[model samples]
Target chain A: MRISWITEDKHTPSVVEYGKVSGEYSEKARGEHTSYQYFLYSSGKIHHVKIGPLHPATTYFYRCGRSGPEFSFKTPPSQFPLQFVVLGDLGQTEWTASTLKHVNSSDYDVFLLPGDLSYADTHQPLWDSFGRLVEPYASQRPWMVTEGNHEIESFPTSYPDSFIAFNARWPMPFQQSGSTSNLYYSFEVSGAHILMLGSYTDFHAQSDQYKWLQADLANVDRTTTPWLIALLHAPWYNTNTAHQGEGEAMRLAMEKLLYDARVDLVFAGHVHAYERFTRIYDNKADSCGPMYITIGDGGNREGLALTFQSPASPLSLYREPSFGHGRLRIENETHAQWSWHRNNDSDAFEADNVWIHSLRSSKECWNHTQDSSLDVHDEF
Target chain B: MRISWITEDKHTPSVVEYGKVSGEYSEKARGEHTSYQYFLYSSGKIHHVKIGPLHPATTYFYRCGRSGPEFSFKTPPSQFPLQFVVLGDLGQTEWTASTLKHVNSSDYDVFLLPGDLSYADTHQPLWDSFGRLVEPYASQRPWMVTEGNHEIESFPTSYPDSFIAFNARWPMPFQQSGSTSNLYYSFEVSGAHILMLGSYTDFHAQSDQYKWLQADLANVDRTTTPWLIALLHAPWYNTNTAHQGEGEAMRLAMEKLLYDARVDLVFAGHVHAYERFTRIYDNKADSCGPMYITIGDGGNREGLALTFQSPASPLSLYREPSFGHGRLRIENETHAQWSWHRNNDSDAFEADNVWIHSLRSSKECWNHTQDSSLDVHDEF
Candidate 1:
């Protein structure tokens, strides 16, 4: 696992000393530090330390620098019965703290965020604040994230590059999954293959994202990785008035690919609301299609998007504008449970819950072998 | 394998379609593109396409971009009988072409270059020329390299960062080996574990490079990877008068770790001459010490270091001022052949040839197990 943090002093070495026991670090690893340019925001060096070849489902205690305080983390299991907490649009706000508190109460394996992490926008120093805000939980488990609209901190002539801060601070293992850009990448954990796609980046037919997605989907082996899930910022099947039609172009360019791959779940977060849809493809219900859901309720300063269009379609099973987080518990190879919790409720209110079956085991989808897709790409 | 190239047009998709046969690209992959900063020199786009999970010891025919020419490369084998060509200080000169021609005549699995690649030296356009000049050889085989003094294209204030072009163009699998910086990394190929150390980077006991090297060396399982080799610029042991004492500090900080690990050989450059040393540690001959060799005679624009200090030490086995390359042919697990070839020789002149026995098989040194080092780090 890779552990990254920042320090004011560049002379301090980037090192992580870790072991299986608390306060007793047996293993040490070192990483490189890089600094980026931000207008009206100059700061210290950012340290990234990658330590690995670790055991699955193991807890490790670590210290960042020589004199820094110690921290601990548990590696994700290699088998089923794994739980992943999904939080989105998580800005540094009071509600975000509540959401985190609610999340911390549960024992989960991984943290997945669609995007809009810091909500810092162009204020680069807030990135440091955001890092500190989530360091407690983020240091304990792997937090996989993607880019959102707000992450595009592009300026006129001074700072033309977008996502410079986001990319630098939140570097992903895109290269491991054959992704050229950290904006979009995939990871397989606990018999599940989760794809973090870049909604803000290019998604045209000839775009690098589209081509990579095609190749990545074609390369999945459903037999081993039974659960196929995807996450992006903009919801393709959102009914909320906020950010409507934002994902239309992306859906038009890549919906067929997902549908054909029989991806079990497609989670998105851009609407700042919660909405669940039936197994749908191209705005219509399809038996083999993915269960699309938008859970952008993790609290940010921008408040709740409480307005939904009147007369929701039949495909829209549930829709709500509330501050909450979701969890996907993969119980076994065939069955999994997905539930969302509202933060305001005194009790853990499971406002929406559903049982999902793996599309790999479904007779309707299992027959569509990966070879057919491979053949299309002329890949062996 | 990752294939990178430049396109004159930004619209051109960075795609590599590949297969096992000629003109039959069955598998297709897409990569990301980026534009970098140069004073006055500007290019369209640099595309880096990574296509992998490929079978080892197999031939792969690939085409980069949409309309680029077809190229082929053979992946290094997983077993013994692997050959690695060692060339250093290889600038784009006629001597470099001659050295390349001499190298191309024989087949090698991997190319180990210890820095000073293009010698563009801040004239960024020369980077393009160097890339084009070596494309035929580089595209066919993996050219693993590190940074050199010449690679530091740092200008006082305008371009303060060093190795911007080198880092962008020649991205290595440093992360794969748990390395945070591309400047230093280790890769296990065939039956050998090769460490590419950065000579220009910080190498103090408290530096990240030192910590990383310690951890990396301790993690190596000599039982699996029997042959342990290392490469770096600035020869630790040199009799050449051109660049003396350049590698003294680095050698002081790192020599003990390599010695304790029983490294079989260490290849270095930067002296602009060919010099080979006997098994030596500290300043004396040790049975378990690495046989350090300087092969900086890779035909750089800077002429050869014609002068060798009089009264050569007994440790310095061979020294010569000529443009040539060296090859290490690991014939088997227990034996290997090291030979240097002179560029002007009509025949493949094995000017300096020696047979090396694996240190792992030596009863004198192999007894110092990895556990002893791991115990020091408290690693499991």
Candidate 2:
């Protein structure tokens, strides 16, 4: 379990107390913070504390600030059939509330917030407020998040540390998972090992992330965890005009590694819309390439990106520009189901549904007979 | 471990998964909420999930709201030297920040927010906001709290659920602890058994609370948990002009029961200041009477109660009108220390310090010849 708080002295300590019950805690640990913020009249020191070696699936109660409400969380079960809630670009808005309402009732196991969390955009207070806004949901689930463009609130003339708020508030398990930066990391849960990559960081073949990604993929054991999923803020496959070609270069640089690793699915967000891509790589149908899905319309103030390419690619199996979230149920090592629910529709009627089957036994298989060149907007 | 969320309908389900590690959870339990809200512009269905039969002194991790940051908490160890923080009348204000800073730094195990959280009054939105404000602290530690005047945000006479907001948000373990109302409950830690009473609820001998209090105290096993601490909102013994005699009626009805039970200390708040009293009952010193300490000075915007009783009660030991909190360290089964700190002073200089020794075995042992009364208002 992780708990955090903010202080102004840059030295006020951060602590966490955890055990199986209240008061009788046998462990006491001090935590540290990274970066500082001096915005308006409010200044802060972000603190992060990690409590660990916890009993898997056991319920543990904890509190972050010295005297706040006690929060508890149960670790996920180690095996298959885990439910996962996937969404992106969830900002503080009425529509965001609608999306959360649906997501909260979905009864999923993992929450993947692929960047653009608060849309603070240099307005740091929004970031703090947004944390509270999502605490009801985020603090209660394993929200595996990544940095999006909006999280890159760079103030060229003032503070140089970008993602200051995001970094301080949500400290990912990067170090434990063998990644150097919170921007990217990997962790195992249920029957899948999730790779949360950084679209805002370096993606060159020689980059640290790339080398780590290669090693991480090489270490995956299909016998224990057969599902491999990669999450990034920007979609490599999209047919929407917004954020078109934004992640194309990155995809070109890293897609081969993922395909080689036999990743079953890739989730992303950025374009304020939803789109599901057919299993393909380098613009051609690939039986082994991971199926890509984008569900970015998470109720940000920015309305949905309604405009799609005039001539949609056959690879774009589904597209919709509406505020919603997705649910992925890993049925087993070989089969998983995905569903996208629009906020405006009935709770039972999914806007789109697809079942993905793993092809882990096939090694690096892909047919290059299709289109040689990929269209950016058509893949959104 | 317990978690919650909200939905439009009253039927949305609640769930908590907990065990040992992040993915080895063996327990999955569904939970439910009791009350909900539908304000002017907002609507909600509160959710509650409980995960239990947790191993004592062990750490467990779980989440609420379907998807959230996984929170971890350790069950309290079976026994002593537990640190308990005692404070009262805290509300959301610039002053509240100072109090929280000090309290957070003190590293207490149990946070006693004896009442007046948020200062939301009838503004129901502040209730939601208050939960987030104290979450950093309360979510970590076990904050044993009770209702104060501010929580008495009575609606129109037509509806008698005066504390609906407070009741919905802060659900105490009253039922689990044997009490029938969330307003009053008792929980044990180390050598101390804390009784959190409701000053707002009925306290007459015939009242349900009175009956419960009698049974709870009668059942205390002094051999194992030798210390008995009482916490309520309004100070039963105060010399401040504000809230003078506010708790007199209740005190008249319940003080003897506590005195007979050989209560170690009575902590309360309501007046906007801090005050300590020599052990006394029926306007006279009694070595066995519970020591009365009022640490209500927990940063509220209403400012402080500067005026004292004209002919200050001979029992008043110390009094101060300032913004701060107090620390109670149960050194052991026989000795405990208390300190009241001023928010603006150096950390080491406590306004008042006292080492209260237990007199549980010596019934009515006061040698009244010591002095009529003592006063320490001059010290503060």
Candidate 3:
């Protein structure tokens, strides 16, 4: 259902026009206390009308004078450089606040939880706790999210429905996905194409997601949109022992497809650690492969994964299990800087940095000239 | 700053023993992956160990294995009940997917928002948009919020914060009163005491908030550990034309003596829409007022202040401007039936139909008859 707002003039007493189209009015009778009206349309559309202009930086929920069902929405000002703080594996624990504080300082457009949000078995109260913690931010900016392992605690029933609870409180683009599910979907932010993938679902070859992924990736044109980033629950080339091979399986299933399409970057969580890999392909370090980043340090109960297990091959670049969050600055299409913030048991601290240069020219690794096939020794 | 995650197992490889009597431990240089560690002492003091559990959920800016400085953290698990979902003035725009979908499915403990949630500003994303939108069952649970004039925009910054940019990414206790500020502070959930009052700061008077607010409220009985709650954007009892007696002209300046008490709920959102009052005293609503509900319909771009001008003495049994948000069940408080959910243009649906008997019996409004002084008159 669709909902809209209307305003009233001080000099004139008139019913605010909720919709420009005919036949858009509230179905529920109006009450003196009820200054607004709700309406439901024949097409299941909903609308809301107010007495006048509303306050800025506030949240609202309404239906158009009973013309349709009720819906909720928040209002934000028009501005640029909409800040979006992106991270994953943010368990509902005390540490989550630190990361939130840092992100909150910036004028971000949204808070993106790529996946692995709350830890496993987080019940309603836990969810409430998380809500309150992030309320300071979500109440202001849109708290956008994707599915993660922790969100899938209960199988079919609770897991899928849990998202419904999240959606009810916040609004998202669940309909964007071809499948009638919130699991996987796509949305646009200015000039960026954000593809949210679901790893818990069937991501194997011939799977619906595989086909969708291919189509979505192929549809992107470098002209209008030069940045293409994909978010999932697990990482493809993590070296942490806790979730070492967890995403390798999924990577094998979709890496080539993503690589062939030249996807720009990929973000994932799950392993309770932080890891960033150099661009690589098929178990080998290649400049063309998407840069893989794992930011699963969102504060949760489970401790961070600390051991790094180098692959039999030399694809792994760096790995750590410190609890923290990552920040990415998409400076144009060719230049991006990524940083990680660690929670040092006291207050949050800054820990790592990486400068990403697009591969528009040279196709070789500027930092490495060693045998590409040599096996790197396993080190923790 | 950039930070990386490192596990304890990678550093010490062996556990160290510390005397239980003393809260001190010997520190040794750790290996590559493990750098910092923590341990709890019998005296309740915490110390750092060569390889021990680091402070959980704190933010640390440290480097990994002699790398550069980066920021990172350990996120808490996505659990139920205590989790929170926060947002502000996030209209149902094209870029709202990430915030909506993410908060929807992920588990949260609680949902807390200061103000200006729905874009009641333009009425484009209405209440129905909120009701039918899915994030899992948060609709059926608790969704708590304060105020933003977007709930009542036409009135001016009559609401609070005058539509300043809200920070939804972080969760902080809105503490401090003598220091009046829009979107003010203080509150609590479970074991935590929170402070959330700040909307209209520049003014002062012998107002309710001014006559009773205090910092000692944080020193509650640890044995009982009843959470403290405090919130206000425009000081619900203010008196202004645009706001019309809203917030009662800064109550904090006069209410600094009530800090030594315990408060459970404190909520506020400008007249634009809705809010729930807490049961505390001073700016702290009492058990008599554990909850101070105010639905500001942040969604209303056009403000709605029909009641303020209405001869109705008591501000609102319930009022709507056309857009707003509500605070659902807080942590498992001992008292009060689950409060009702309030929105802008829709019939108040029982978002969660649970009875907060504990809260109800302990509060002042328990058996009090509905105040008839304020005539709620509207034609349906």
Candidate 2: where is the Cα deviation over 4 Å? A7-13, A19-29, A39-43, A361-380, B1-380
TM-score of chain A of 1: 0.97
Question: Which CAPRI level is candidate 2?
Answer: incorrect
Q: Per-residue alpha-carbon lDDT of model 2 for B77-164, expressed as tens digits?
A: 5666777778888887778888887887755667877888878655455666667777677656667788886786543212236677
Q: Which of the CAPRI classes, incorrect, acceptable, medium or high, describes model 1?
A: incorrect
A141 Cα displacement, candidate 1 (Å):
72
Residue A67 displacement in candidate 1 (angstroms): 62
Provide the lDDT at B248 for model 3: 46
Candidate 3 wrong stretches, greater than 4 Å: A1-83, A120-122, A155-171, A177-179, A310-314, A345-350, A359-380, B1-380
The first chain of model 3 has a TM-score of 0.70
By descending lDDT, how would the candidates be arranged?
1, 2, 3
- Give TM-scores for every candidate, taking all chains together and pairing residue i with residue i: 0.50, 0.47, 0.39
Candidate structures ordered by TM-score, highest first: 1, 2, 3
Better of 1 and 3 by DockQ: 3
CA shift of B37, model 1, Å: 1.2
Give the alpha carbon lDDT tens digit for every residue of A23-127 in model 3: 443232222211211111011111122222444343444443443343443443332223346788776666777766666554545567877554423233344
lDDT of 1 by residue, B1-380 (tens): 68888877878898999999999988999988877866435655888888987888999998888676888999999888999999999998899999999999988999999999997765576788899999999999988998877786754224556678988888888997888998899998979999999887788888888888989988888888999999999789998756556678788889998998889999999878899999999999998999999999999876688988899989999999999999999999889999999998854779999999999889888777454666646743
Q: What are the per-model DockQ values?
A: 0.01, 0.01, 0.01
- Alpha-carbon shift of residue B188 in model 1 (angstroms): 1.2
